[model samples]
Target: MVSNMAGGQPPWHGTEPDAPLGALEVYAEQAHGYLGASGDQLGKLAGLLRPPVLESWLRSLRGRVDPMDALDDRGLRGADLRRYLQAHPIAALMPLIDKLLVEDTAATGLMVVVADQFGRVLSVQGNDERVAAAAEVGLRAGDDLSERRIGTNAIGLVVRTGRAAWIHGPEHFLYRMRQITGAAAPVHDPDGRLVGVLMIAGGVRVARPEILALVKATATAAEMDLLLTAMRPGQRDAARRDAGRPQPAARLGLDVLGLGQPQLSIADRRIPLSQRQAEILLLLAEHPEGLGADHLALLLDDSDLDNGTIRAAMSRLRAVVGPAVFGSRPYRLHVPVATDVEALRAALDSGDVDSALRLHAGPVLPRSTAPGIIDIRDELRVRLRIAVLKSGDPGVLRRWTSGAEGRDDAAAWTAYRATADPETALYAQIEAKIRVLDRRMGADATRMQRFGA
Candidate 1:
């Protein structure tokens, strides 16, 4: 999309992954530098970021968010969210949202998220798995995507400038959130009052120049729907109506295994979580039956912690996670919590070792020492090792043996040897490593026997 070029704040357009549309490489590189730059260096390279993104970046910087801070972005939820939704004009537009954006895009694998003028997400509707993926990254209903909260996102940009906009991957302010790309448009009520922002989040497939147009079109449709729905009989005027829309909301991913750093991805942001938080969350996820506060406390720690302490901890966690996720009768998850662990388990159970290997990023929460976490960790590790050994595929075995967890695994190395032709150098190397391990094991056994004496 060419620069329309008019006012100080120009009417914005869309984004493409690469040129003949725009200089994505140049802008992305400059964004990286701009985000890293110190005070004076920041102004020096101002022109490169494209005025819209730079302005939003400035607003984001002025706001509470730090580009480098771990994103803990949240929106509204529970009773408070229900009240807000009921009162907001966007509430009437949900049917249109469900029909035009959510249902139409279901098979296309895109996601639709609606946010108020403040950029706090109102509703997220789409394919079930896609919605779950979005939730993992803090992009669910009641989560804020405002420039002040998450920084330089498509939704927040539209709110900042009151125009249609698209933000590409690296254009995002938060560092870890650079994996996402999205396009958004502002929805105006029939009276032209700013209703909210509609965003479509997805992968690079959404980076095409037409994405903003699609967003704009859907946003316009939402606006028109508000108009028609608001009109009583034959009311025909711009003043009679009310609305908001998205990026694909589609490509959501939760990574608990990558480098053992657990993060949630929705749209273009990856909200980071603490290890303890991740442990409690994943444990809750494991037990669909829901653990009681006492049992939950025991699972979280070996010590006999009181329910009050657990409740306090749960309260703090609930603030970060929002209220709709957990139920009180028994501490249970109200939604499907997908993780690399579950994905890997599914893959392994289906006898798909290749998929399991791809999903296994070392052991789950490698540093976690909680008994429940340790239990899951050990169980998953053993299961993965068994699957890897059973595969007999040299490439799969090589991948397993290459990891730190499996580097000294004698069985895996032996399996690799069995799969390889004896003449191959790889086979010889496996043999050599196994011999070293055997010698080490024998020496350790001898030392143990002497100690027993």
Candidate 2:
């Protein structure tokens, strides 16, 4: 590995040809200049880079004269580079790329070029014969071969379309392109920005569908690495968006357990949910407490039924909700999946606030209007409303509790009326509220920072 440890090196300075061009690209050429070669080493480096006609040809291409015209210009400036290096550390991806090339020597026979989000070459890897051949046509590591320069190649087309693309055989726009087939796929950051492009090039004989699949796979692998490295747990999904895959909808605990009725959205999609199942889900979601059979039966207006009948309802409810909620416990439903209450409890118990915050997506149950579940729902409303007061910041809480003001106030007053001793359960409620408010405030700050507000 070339050592560009000093401050003035190019981004690719100390990196091996297979390594990514991360922060090192921003420094002046002198930084990387040292690693480029001196005396006999210069000849060896030149042989690998394949200078002369190749460099001259690249210099003539359109969009070939800017700072990014050369691969060395892809590194960000001081602050931007710091931000980038913090997340997109070259250390993680470079080793993997090197291993891929070394292990897949036969596959590496094809010209492989890696570029920054802006289409500037970051690195290139190829076997000797292919390197020489590509050099003849002005394609080498760190060269500006964007579509704007060479016109309609895989790299350029993928960049333009933000999708995987192939420019095979005669599809090349340039007159000198008859020698190869290339496939390029977009690589994205957690934000779905075009962070990089990965391309594979080979002669027509190797232009099979599998070859394109390999290229796309490489791009996807690269993106997953970037996302895992950069994102805090929640932001990882945003990175996957570049694949154009819809996220599986957020699984409310009941849905995960198949205990709720499915309602059709505006798309007229039917979601199947039984009335009893829906009632139970809404009730649990409304009241964090496990509802006793007697309580449930009363609220359900099924007083005429015997205890055995109520027990049957409770048994059915338990089966539908899945065993994960609570293990043979009576009357208390505890969805195994973390809710705000559980997350706060975890944070309090374990002192891992990030873990707690990550687990809590919203209030335990969100936005249901089941009339039969109203009594339990009111309890949940009061608990959460008190939680808001204690926490002091309602950030996303307001969104969660939106339009439930009447119910929430009613619940608060009802709770006050039920317990004559004002001090009862007061500490627990205060603690929950304090934690919730703090969380909301932090979330708000995060949203503001993301939007530059």
Candidate 3:
């Protein structure tokens, strides 16, 4: 019957009356005894505890998790943090979660938490007093509630099992958490992929079996709302675009333009790529004829790595990108993959400077130092800069100069000075920068002459 509860249906429904409050109390007491028992006594106590709670406890013991350890609240911060908060598919569920769970339970000794698929808490909404109390235990936005991080909590369990879970009092792996009860249900996207978990936690004063139904119903409503929103006219086009046409394998897209970390998008999932993986994929895409392990290692700037090391890396990449996407014999992409670097090159080749600028995300894996990657990265930067300067487009020049890449670019600044309107403030700024550059170049020339270069 865990499945019944997971499906948003109470197991007791259409059967005998619900388990009495006394039953939960007894379960909590037994769980406490099990928690306090020594290694030898644990074997005897196991038979008395509920199967799910007992299994969870065993897992905690196997993992060697401490029952008194403080909770972890670390996660994404700054712009990277903002991006996840804004672009996550579960973002649409916030209002509904607030209305049904947070507001409804305010001042009732309860708190509502919403977390991403990885069990990193995205938002926490609840009664002010209860929220403060929860924060004392590190329960708040950006907190990681994964079972690996916090042991056997309901939010982490729901995320791990994709099932609704209710953990009361001593069922919690952490002794400090035993004063509360938690009920959580997983939220799925319209495509039926698990997106996040919605959890309600309350002090012992509000513990009740009915809380399970409330959490499940709220999750169901949030999912329904997500589906309905996706069906709306404005959202339908985007949904369709995201779904794409069915292909033999998911298309891979890489963005490695500038200073930002490179990201790989496989269908709807966008994952960050390690520098080595990015270099390998970029090389593979550049050489559709494929590369042997030796050549690939050289291209990766690691000549000492043997074939086995390369194979191990490829295996790890395969786990993320899928086996169908990578071919053996000669390592290369077996399926079609698109990258922003290629998009920019194509745009520039076709004389579409605007499109090229738009496609240029940042720099080609700016942190990468591999010889091949450096060549490609430098080539792309030079080509784009030359094209932008030659195009005589003020809009393009302005965009380039305004960004981090062009902030001190002498060529871009000179181009802007030549093309910009004299009446404009930008022209004055460019003029000042040109003077600064001229003086610097003059100083460099003097140094070279004085040093007999």
Query: Which candidate's lDDT is highest?
Result: 3
TM-score of 3: 0.51
Q: Which has the higher TM-score value, candidate number 1 or candidate number 3?
A: 3
Instruction: Please write out the lDDT profile of model 3 over residues 1-453, one tens digit for every residue.
Output: 122112232222211113343554455465566655677767744544455666777777765567778655345445434435554657667778888888888777678888888777777777787777877776667666677556788887887789888777766777777767778889887898898998888766445557778888999998999788657785446536544331333456777777777778754668888878888888997877899988888878745779998999999887666656778889977765667776566556545576678888787888887888988988998889888878777778889988888776777777778887899988898888767866877756534432434
Candidate 1 structure quality by residue, lDDT tens digits, 302-416? 9998989888878876765556567876988764455667657655644557667887878788887789988989898888888787777777899988998888777777778
Models sorted by TM-score, best on top:
3, 1, 2
Estimate, for each residue in 288-336, the C-alpha lDDT of model 2 and write its tens digit: 5566665656656634446687677666755544344443234554432
- Report the CA-based lDDT of candidate 1 relative to the real structure: 0.70
Note the Cα lDDT for every prediction shown.
Answer: 0.70, 0.46, 0.72
Give per-residue lDDT, candidate 3, residue 324.
66
Q: lDDT (0-100) at residue 323 of candidate 2? A: 42
What candidate 2 gets wrong by more than 4 Å, as runs, is: 1-91, 106-108, 231-453
- Model 1 has a clash total of 22
Off by over 4 Å in 1: 1-26, 234-453
- At residue 38, give the lDDT of candidate 3: 75
Q: State the TM-score for model 2.
A: 0.33
RMSD of 3: 22.2
lDDT of 1 at 201: 80
Q: In model 3, which residue pairs have backbone atoms overlapping below 3 Å?
A: 257-362, 257-363, 257-364, 258-362, 258-363
Model 3 alpha-carbon drift over 4 Å, by segment: 1-40, 71-83, 233-453
How many clashes in each candidate? 22, 18, 5
